[model samples]
Target: MPTQIVNIKDQLFENIFDHAPNGVAIVGLDFRWVKVNQSLMDLLGYSEEEFYAMTFPDITHKDDVAADMELLGQLLNGAINRYQIEKRYFHKTGKVIWGLLSVSFERSPIDGAPLYFISQIVDITRQKEMIGQMNAITNIANIQNEKLKNFAHIATHDIRTHLGNLGVISGFMEEELEVLKNNENFLMLKEALSQLESTIDNLNEVRKSDFSTEERMTSLNLKDFVDSAIYNINAIARHEQCKLINEVDGTFNVMAVAVYLDSVILNLLTNAIKYSSKERQSYVHLRSLESEDYIILEVHDNGMGIDMEVHQAELFQFKKTFHNRADARGIGLFLTKNHVESMGGKITVESRVDVGTTFRVFLRKA
Candidate 1:
């Protein structure tokens, strides 16, 4: 070749090797590293001398070497002139790096032999990381979706049962009130009517326990909250021959929505009183404990407890009543659990038949 032609060819070769954005490696036909540029050194974390001493096979991950060697055989057999694949390269630090590798053959200008195997490696580590994160998030979402579906089914059943009971009770009250309209005990009848109205209002509030409007949350005093809720349910407690024991002392604050917290406490307390053993009087204890990041408010009752082995799975379900009684509507614990978790809290139950039940409500520390 002429001297000027040789000089232009050398300049073109230098430009391609030095300025390529992707990692470029020139290997001998024997699969030994012949040259490496700055990009290749950066991608593989190898120095120029270190890379030159290693063959292409030496830097490939052990798991990928077999498949890569098979591809190489195919390439050498003239099955393909160029091929692209995602492969892993072992860095000098022994870390695996994902890369989109494109390999092509080049014939020598002097000998017309297969003197060069030119490979370009495009790094794709960040893409792989993002894919992994997306998959993890998808799995978590799937789990939550199943949980929510089960919750909805239970809530619907319990609410329907409660509404049915309320309908029957209201109908009875109407008939009795009509009979007592002209009786000598009119004042007592009127008082009973007022109490029924109040009870109905409270039930309405419980039914509307969708606290989705609250955008903010804060630590609330458990003692005060329960006391206020008990005051509201005092009439029902008295009529049911129930006693509420307040063991919660001081302010045990937890991050929660005010309405939701009130509804949760009220429902659990009423549930205890409602399910009290018919032969014995009902009593409830509202207690609290402070932990590092949560406040646990336990509502314990000496009422009819649960059979955990048979009912644990369905305990938080809507409208699933364990006892086949006219008053067992089953929405109390369902609503309580929903209200608790909606504000980033949790509720769990421990119980034994006839012994009693304890509901542990865990809320974020104030």
Candidate 2:
């Protein structure tokens, strides 16, 4: 009677273990599976007998073994009572199985020594697939954006060039027929030619822009570039009585692609000259300094400053002209912004009406 009672109790415990919702496993200190429930067998596409013959390390993915062992070592040292982690395992049919694995330990009855490890596994393969899909979508979007920028450059440059040649031909006609210029159709043609010329100039700026932010950069001397920009804008600076001061130290260097940096500097300098304050002797100063993460260059000018409250939002937008100058093609600052960003830098302006404007560019430190 006693033997029959013991057998019945054992069968009841076995039935309960087999019917558990999650895959339950028992591993010994040797990292060998001592017992595995039916759930684990089905999830891994392996028979219970095959699992018993294989050790935990044999089934674990190679990339995950080191981390698994480290945590197991911690548990054995009594540092943690239990551990739960998401890990990858190899399935029997050669596919990857992502498992949420939870492990704990049981002690021996006599000496309280760890006798075995108990684990529960949950399949998370669908979640991993979803994350991979999201990454693929993000890559596609980045590629599309690059293609669009290239298309804009090609369309603007090609059309603008054709229009520019036509305007030149029209200008020649003006000199050829001074008497005919007074005619209504002749005046209208001249006005249209002038507008087309301005559009072409603006398109030329974007045509010269650099749109690749991933280009490898060389170290550029801050003062050298500033000097070159001043040289390019010398005539306007002289006309405005603007003093071009290169105060940046000779030793300061930043990482940038050369042509992009040149365009950005020239644009800012020209803007300073164009808007110089008439009330005072105008000055544009080029200075640079090193910060924690960036090399900063500042173009400080005492100029007819912008109304930040009004035109702030459109400051660097393409064709966004605020000052009503006839030659304000409205493309310099826009191209300046694009080139600055392409070289892993950013541009910002601080201005108050009648006070002055400061354009600050933050570049990658070499």
Candidate 3:
């Protein structure tokens, strides 16, 4: 009865080892296969007889052999009891496949003599391929972003020169025809030119605030920045009959580029006041909220809110306007969004037509 029980235990061990899902093998110190399960044979596309005649180095990718040997040497010298690595193996079909190889050794219990190695391999070919694809996409996007920066720089320089010459010519015309200065059409043209110049200046500011890999960020007090924005925009807020309220906490600081942060805050505040509702008491409120990774600054307003259902898609697009106001050049939100994102932040909006709008800017917590 004792002998039968021992046999049953041995059979159970063999069954469990052989039916394991991942490749499993017992290898000698020479790295030669001494025993292998069906999974191991199927993984490397080899038969039991073939595997026995071949050493692990025979199937290992040539480039990976050196690292594999180095780690194996550590294990052999008792420097490590086990090791794991991502390695490539050449299949019988002459193709390379990726595997996560984990190896440890068995030793004689009485004398502590190294016996053989137990290697388990799990296929990671699909995951490696997916990582490669994502890397390629990231590279492409980086290249495109750099190109956009260069284009904006060049365009701003050239357009500014042309506008300067046009401005000079317009001045000459106005002086030569003094009566024309008072004409409504002439005034309109001059106002349009002035607006164009302002638009270009905004674009240049946006270009200047573009983030670069080497640019260092500074820690800024959120409340201080909000206060500065409110001070500068006070005249406009008063002119528009909109109240400005600052609720950002003094304790909260954010990592940001100074010019970029200023532009983002000012734009949101100005927009809120500019679009304030005429039917009710209008106010623009600024506040901040905290998260583990980000400081969310919010600008809320009771304004002539956007019809989000209709303009959501075009909200942040350049030259896309949702309002009929003469000052609505449609680039404020566009520039604001660019500035926020360039600083490794993000912007989102929530609005209801004729009700109110809230703009949230998420910045890295300092």
lDDT of each: 0.80, 0.83, 0.87
Going through the candidates in the order shown, the clash numbers are 5, 0, 0
Winner on lDDT between 1 and 2 is 2
Ranking by lDDT: 3, 2, 1
Candidate 2 per-residue C-alpha lDDT over 1-366 given as tens digits, one digit per residue, 9 for 90 to 100: 599998999899788679877788999999999998988988898898899899998989999989988989999999999999999989999999999999999988899899999989999889988998998999998898789778867877787777778777877887898876788666656565554455456555544656444654679887787776665566567777999998877787889866677778878888888888899999998899789878899999888899989999999998888777998998999999888888888888999888799999998887
Q: Per-residue lDDT of 207-245 in model 1, one digit per residue for the tens?
A: 455544345576678788887777767777888888988
lDDT of 1: 0.80
* Two-way lDDT contest, 1 vs 3, winner: 3
- For every model shown, what is its TM-score relative to the native structure? 0.46, 0.46, 0.60
Tens digit of per-residue lDDT, candidate 3, span 282-359: 998888999888999999998999999899999999999888988789888999998888878899999999999999
- Model 1 weakest lDDT span, ten residues long: 184-193
Query: Could you tell me which residue pairs clash in candidate 2?
Result: none
Evaluated at residue 332, the lDDT of candidate 1 is 79
* Weakest 10 consecutive residues of candidate 2 by summed lDDT: 198-207
lDDT of 2 at 63: 90
